[model samples]
Structures are given as structure tokens and as C-alpha cells.
Target: MTTKPAIIILSASALAMAARLATELDGEVHGLRKRIGDDAEVTFDDVAAHLVGLFREGRPIVALMAAGAVIRLLAPHLGDKTREPPVIAVAEDGSAVVPLLGGHHGANEMARRIAGLVDGFAAITTVGDIKFGVALDQPPEGWALANPETAKQVMADLVAGASARLEGDAPWLADSALPLSEDGGIALLASDENVNTPVSGLLYRPKRLVLGIGCERGCDPAEVLALAKESLSEAGLSAEAVGLVASIDVKADEAALHHVARHLGCPVRFFDAATLEAEAPRLINPSEIVFSEVGCHGVAEGAALAAVGASGELAAPKRKSRRATCAIGRAPHPFTESDLPGRGRGRLFVVGIGPGSDGWRSPEVSQMVAASTDLVGYSLYLDLLGPLAKGKVRHDFDLGKEEARVRHAMELAGEGRSVALVCSGDAGIYAMATLVFELLDKADGPEGLSDGARRIEIAVSPGISALQAAAARVGAPLGHDFCTISLSDLLTPWEDIKRRVRAAGEGDFVIAFYNPVSKKRRTQLAWARDQLLEHRPASSPVILATNLGREGETIRVVPLGDLNVDDVDMLTVVVVGSSNSSTVATGDGRTWVYTPRGYARKEGTAMTNSFSGDAA
Candidate 1:
């Protein structure tokens, strides 16, 4: 779960308190629309549905309302308490803080923290927290509860005046106010072993082990996972003890390494070659061949030592399958995410923001932009992100620098930074997604990508393209067979483009023309218009959608015979209808274009009659 909570306020009265909490918690304020001013980060019309949606997404929520109201809204969705995120209800006047759900999962702590900030009382009602000052079911970070089902009975006994004894090394628990005795009735065992002796008390596993892995390019994920499990079995260490998976930076994009980390239920971190090579003296099986390939003497063992720090030791020697290697390092104590030194595997999210409109932008694109540490795009594309662009490192490029933007995004990710390469409309349609792969495909050429850049993970999140937006506004222009063609001859030869246009026209495909015209380039759109008229009727409907999903947007339809190059620009998408397409005037005196997909042929068929009867 994210550390940043969602501070939800329902009225203007709670706006000041919500703003204070948001600033203190590094959270975003979600306010009720029209009830609060623009000071809130986001405004929603429906409070109950929005709160439930945030709860379902596992985001911690700090709602400034009555505790009963929050409970009433979320009562129907409540089930597993273990999986629910922290839900706290703070009074609108900031006088009281009540943890209504997930009391053991940081809710109580957050309540107390917020109460202290507002000079109010923390109404923590959990018996175990009040008596022992610790939640046995939900242990601290980097510690896993081996048997959580037994925690309720154990906590009940402890709350019923039964003393407990600590049986292992746990510095955090040692400071808690639990009634500890040598011969107590209940025992708390903390160990890295896979204990399965039906303990009478809670069994916790301290995550002190770091699993290091390395594999050849395109290694099998199953092979790496099996080797990791076998190495853990041989070392007598529990999988719960693995706090992190470490590897050299060059294997950051390796599928097998990520698969193993997922199987182990831990995050994966990567060290650069220089950092991994610093542990050469401690590698159990150093190899010069490994150094020649990835600049590290031993990928598995060196990464393990590099992650475990100098005081740690190699708990398990290097083990290998056919194409993968695994090693284990043990720290003296459990470690959390902040304790790890190396950066996580870099990821490049190539996302399309969808024509400068928040309504047209997809939720996935918004999430990708939120998760990114750096935003790389043309200046206009980045500006379209609005509130989501706050606090992100922006790298703006001018027009005609497509290769430069992609290369810079890849380089930033190679250094273990989360990057978002922003584009307009759909990322896969005439956008940066193709350029990213083009560079990756030529990673070994004279002016190719760096070794680290070649290994960064890349994902493309699509958005509504200009063709789809234009087609939707004009009504069904792309409902039938269609193709998209770019008219710019800067990258491709004009002869080839003309060949595609002629083929599309002959094939009776509705064509959406992109890059229809530029300031210096002309005659292409007019020539194409004339060429398309040869195959189709001169009365064919042609749509010129300009500045779609933005200010000063215009959608105009003209005949194929009247399609002048002066009406088209770089921002306009020209859609020429097929030979069989038609336009009709509605009752409201508006023109609607549509291409019939042979539905009229089935009008008298039995299948159509049966569907009509079913609808009736």
C-alpha cells in the first residue's frame, strides 16, 4: 500500500483540517464538489461511492466526518480485516481521532499521530494495542506473521491477564509494554526458520535474508523460481525471511528475476555494476567471465553481499541451474524498505494522455503518470497532465526531437528512475512507443543504447487516438473497414505513402489521414484528395476534425471534391469515408455520417427477426 493517504473532506467546514492533514501526511485532499473550494487537490460529486472506491483500491483514507457515517458507508463491503487498508475518522473540528477499521494495520498509529498534530484525543479501542502496545497479527515492516489465525486467541489471553515471554531476538517487541516473564503462559517466537510445531502463541518470521539472483537473457521463469525455492530449502530458511531480491542492474528487465521475486513475495532491487563489483572480495564463487559480461565478478553472490552491507554474511553459497544462479545473505536484524541501499528496477511507462482532455485520458494513463518520478515529453503534452504533474521532474522537449525524448527517458530509467514518456493521443499510433522499440532493436549498433538502458523495463499504456475521437464526434465513420495513413513525407517516401493511399482507396477502406499538412508542406493533402476521388464518389463525406478534445475544437464535413489543403493542418485529422458510406440529416438538422456494415442485408433474414422478437 502507498504511504500517502487520501484526506477526504465532505464540507467546507473540514477544509482547513483536511489541508493540514494532507500537508502533514503528504497526502492528497479529496473534497466534495461545490461544498469545498478549489484549495482541495481533487473534487468528487459523490462522497460515499468515492470513499468506497478508494477503500477497494487499498489506499489509506482519512475521512473528516463522523465515525458512524464512514462505517455506514463501508459496512456492506467489509469482509477480511487483514487485507483492508487503514480507515480513520477525524472530527471536522479536529477534536477527536477514531480508528474505525484496520486498527492493527497502522490505523491506530496514524490516529495517534494525527491527534498529536491537532491536539486532540486518539480514541483507540483495540484491547491488544491498549494492553501490550503491539499488534501481534500485524507485525512491523519486514516481519511476517507465520500463523495469523492463532493471533486472536493469543491476544485474547494476553488481554485477559495472561503474561507472555519473548523467545527470540526482536528489538521492536522488546520495547513494547507487554507483560513479559520467563515462564509466561504464552510465548512469542521470532525466527527465520520454517517453524511448524503447532505453537501455542504467535509465530513471527523476521525478514533478515536477502535473495540474490542472476540469469541469462530470456531465461525460463520457472527455472529461476525453482532454483530459489531449492536454495531456500537447502539453507533451512523460510521464504518469509526473504526481505528483498537483489540483482545487477543489467538484469533489471529480466523476466526470470522478477518472477522469482513475485514468488517470494518481496520487492526486487538492483545495484549498478560498479557497486556490485565492490563486493568481489566477499564472493564465494567469483568468475572473470561474469565480470567480462556484466562488469561484476559474480552477479548472484556479489549482489547479495552488496545488499546485506558489510556486517552481513553469506548464509547460502552460490547455487545454479542451467541458466540461473541464486545466493542468500543474512543480516543481523530485520530490514525495511528504507534500510535497503540499492534502487529498484527501473521502469519506463510510455503513456498517451489523449488529446489534452481529462475526460479522454484513461485511468491507467493517470496511474502511470502518478507512479512516475520523471515526466519526459513535448511541453504541451506535459502541460496536459494538470494536477498530476505537480512535484514530478519535468524534461520538456521541443517539436521534431522524437528520438532525443525517447533516448533521454531510457537513460533516466537506466539509472533506476521511474520515467513516463508522455505522448498525445494513442501511444502506439504514430507515437513514442514505436521509437522506444526501434532504439531497443538496434541496441547493439554503432550509436545504440547503453547496456543499462537496454535492460530497463518498458510498458505502453494506450489512450483514445485522434481517429477514434474524430470518428466518435462525427458518428461511425470508422464503423467499417478502415486504415490510418500519415501524409508527412519526412520519414517515408512520398511514393510509398501514395501507394498506401491508392491501395486503401481501392480496397474501399475508410481512411484517417494523420499529419495531413504542415506549414512548409502542401499539395500532398490536395493530391491525395484527388487520388481518393478516382476510386470513390466525389460526394463522399470527408471529416476534418481539428484540435479535438481541446479548446477551439471544430468538426466539419465537406465533399471529397471540395477538400482543399488550406482547411487541414497538423492538428487536424482528415477522415475520408468509403465508397459505400452515407450521410443523413437528423430531425435536429444535424448531419451524421455512417458506413453501413451490411446490417441491411440481414433485415429480412430469420436471424434478425429472432433478435427483434427477443428484444420485444
Candidate 2:
């Protein structure tokens, strides 16, 4: 997958140009913290460190700075040209654009694209691009080079005044400035087959072949892979020519199908049963058994025909192994992922974006949100995503529609779209992860999860929870054993909430109260505080954390006896210290709370042992 570029700016002066580029390229803006304002999506404290990090993440970098500066910053990290992403430098005033590295691997093209947007000059320095207006080693989209090592010598020979012969159709090469002749010194062969070309020639594989697959639930990955390879070998087709691995949507999460795609180094796509059934007339081996099983007459043949469209033909008929079937289809022209009709395996990422700050959000959560096609959550939670939410199809729900939000996300993923079910804090805590599973467990009864929904791959990415954020803001109130209880009587009965609070007091465990209070539910906080006071002293510390990581953030420590319900709200998390917890006033005039974990007893024992040894 191609990642969106990171437009890095150093000062506010470049913010305007960076914004324009970001919009044009569909990229994100990263700026220096103090120099740039809120217009920049992300802020960085260090430039070199940030650039290196983006480079390592394999994200293209478009720095609106001097070319020399970017070159110097990325010099040490420049080793593998093949593995590096495009790095471009654009003049802050939008006058000049330079491709600093990865010239063949998209840097040159990106620089030219930016220059076009700014009406500036793209400083393309690659000799192949300048001479023939094409890079043989780095073919355009929908084409793969079989022998890249031969490109360097061939280009050298061409530069030394050698003519080339075109074996097959390739408009980009034929239209270039390359000197072509019927019987030239070098041959450029473009074919979808695994052919034996001349030693001095270049073999280019056009992406016109589709590998359609079908397998049992627990089919061995090796068996599927071997069958696919054997089918391609018999058809005289190259693996590099395989554009897509397609199957029924019901097998979206099948391990064997994914393994086949990975082995062929191609993306896997899926078609709904109804869509596949439409291609049943064209199937070479349509079966009624398959129609009864999956609502499709043929899994392999029908999927292959659907991918190739009406103008194409099957290169190979259905070939079956022990538990898997494979078929190949050839399209009239090369295609990309966007040209296909169906989607890939759907993925539902239940992600926790952390409290609110970008710093607190986990990198894994950021990556998942970035990769998702749609975002589903409460409006406030989706808004907290900030720049990460840009360009995504958002499905916002009201505060009270938790079940509706999860159901919508699951259904969206069932349609072969990548959906992110957004949540606050850790998703597995009291968030939507549990609700998602609950609905899935009851799929047969009331929730009625579709087969496609059940087949989607589900994952949970943990985030920094509210309890951890509150404890970090304060001292070590959670240093000892602790338990969390929700004081909201809406879900659980008031008697049950009070019982848990009383049990926590009897156990002398530090308690963190979630959903502490609402407008109509103010008495629960006060009641919990009174119950905890009966066991611990009235002077025990209680930390009230409101808007933990967002605006109007406040952290206050008060005596348990002085805690009032008016000071708490639904947004506040109340943490009451245990009986052994103590508050100490440090030299900095800050009061820190901590509970002893019995380390003092170990220290005293060690001292007594040393004294006894001295006396003996």
C-alpha cells in the first residue's frame, strides 16, 4: 500500500505552501512546534529525529526546506536505495522542487507533480528519466521488471549509443526517446509469460493475470500455495504477472487464501456471493454443490471471470488439489487495485486513541486509523482524531448509541471495507471491544451478524487508559492493589454499585471510580466517598482527574472527608487512596500520594542482619 506523504515544514512562513501541497498530494503536514502554528497537523520538537523516524517508517517526505539541509540530515541513513521511500525538497516559497533520493522509486515523479502544482521547476537528475523519459528498472504502475540487474548495463549500453528492439506492446517504452529498431543490439521483452529472453535483454511483466482461489476452512497454506504455483506453471504464466488473488467474501479471513497472496507478493481481493453468481454462465466448471454451499455456482472459475471482465478469457481452467482450487484469468489490459470491482478482506480495528492529546495516542492506533477506510465512533471521539481523521468517511453516533456504533462498524467491514471502531482510552477496558464480542456471541439470537461480518478480521490496539493517565498525573496512588468500579446506576443497580464500593473499602484496596456522576446522578460520588471514609481515615487522599488529556484539564487532590459530589462529573475519574496510602509534601511545594508496598519491612530486616553480624 502507498502511504500518504509527510509534508515537513520548519517555520510558519512555509505553512501556506505546505498546506497547499498536503491538499494536492493528499498528505499530512508536520511542522516544528514553536515555529509553526495549529495549521500544521503534527508538531515536532526535533527536525533530524523526526525526518529519520518518518524515513524509517517508509513514508515519503516532502520537506519545504533547502535541498542541502534535507540531504545532510538524511545522509547517514542512505544505504539501500531499493528499500527507501521518496524524499523530495521543495523551496519554501514554492519556486524549486528537487528529488533528493529514490529517483527511480517515485521521487522524480512526486517532484514533478509538486512542481506542476506550484508552476515551478522539478530538478529531475536521473539520466534514464532525462534521456528516454522512462526508468526501465522502475516500471510504471501495473508493470513489474523481472530482471532489474540487467537494466543498469542496458541503460549504460543505450547511453553509449546502442539501439533497442521492442518484443511486445508497451506504450511507455515505445513512445520514449529510446532508439528502437526491428533488429537492434538489445531486446526489451514485455510479456505475461515466464519466458526465456536473450541474456542482454530486459523482461517486463505486465499485470494482466488474475489468480482466483478457493479452499476449505482449514486448508493447509502450503497446499494452497503449491497448487497456485503449479497452476501458474502449467499455464506458462509468471508469478510477477499475477495482479490479484481473488476469492469469495466468505473466505476473506481464510488463512490459506492470504498465504497464497503473500507468497505471490500480490494483494488479495474478495467478491460477494451474489456478484460471483452473476459470472456463473462464464465458468468453465460450474457446480451446483458450490451454489448450494456458498450461493455461487463456482468459487474459482466464477471469481476469475469476474476479475477479468467481459473482454477477457480464462488462461487456465479450474485445477484442484486436496482441498483447494485454483484458476487463472487474463485481462485485455493491465489494471490496478482501484480498477477492480470488489474489495479485499475486511478488517475491523477496535482502536483506543488515548485521552485526547496526539502525544498520548499510541503509534499503533495512529497507523490503524490512517489505514482504515472509514471511522466510526462518538462525534467527540472522532473529532479528537484531528488530522488523522482527515479524508476518512466518518460515521458519527450520539452519546447513547454505543451498540449502534459497533454494529455499524461491523457491517461496514462486512462490505469489504477497512473500518476503525474508535474508542476512548483502552478499548478492552470498558470500551467498545467487549460490546463488539458480545454482539458477535449473540449473532445467532438477536444481533444477527451476517456471514461476511463474522468472517472479517478483528483486532484490538491498546491505548493509554484513563486510570493510567490519572495515576500518572498524580503520584503512585495505584502502587498497591487496586480495583475499578463504575458508579453509574444506569447499567448496574445502585445496590450492586454500593456493594462493590463497600467490598473495596473492606479490602482496603485503592479504588478508581469510572462514570462517577452525571447531572441527574450526583449522589453516587458522595455516597462512595462516605463508604470509603468509614474504613480509611477522613484525611486519606482522593484524586479527581477531569478532562484528563484534553482542554480544561485539571488534577486535584483533596481529603476524602472534603470530597463533594458537586466537584465531580461524568468526565471526572475519582481515585480514592487505600488506608496505608499517604500524602507527602515535597520540597517543590507539591503534594504527592503513594501507597506502601511493604518495602520498608525488607529494609529494616536487612539492617538488623548487618548489625547482628557486626556483634558476632
Best by TM-score: 2
Tens-place lDDT per residue, model 2, 483-512, is: 999988877999998899999999999999
lDDT per residue, candidate 1, 66-103, as tens digits? 89999999999999999999999999888999999999
| Candidate 2 regions with alpha-carbon error over 4 angstroms | 584-588, 595-597, 604-616
Query: Each model's RMSD to truth, in Å?
Result: 4.7, 5.0
Off by over 4 Å in 1: 1-3, 9-19, 31-49, 65-69, 215-218, 284-297, 320-324, 583-591, 604-616
Reference-based lDDT, residue 265, model 2: 78
Against the unseen true structure, what C-alpha lDDT does each candidate score? Answer: 0.87, 0.88
Instruction: Assess the local accuracy of residue 129 in candidate 2 as a C-alpha lDDT between 0 and 100.
Output: 88
lDDT of 1 at 347: 85
Tell me each candidate's TM-score.
0.90, 0.93
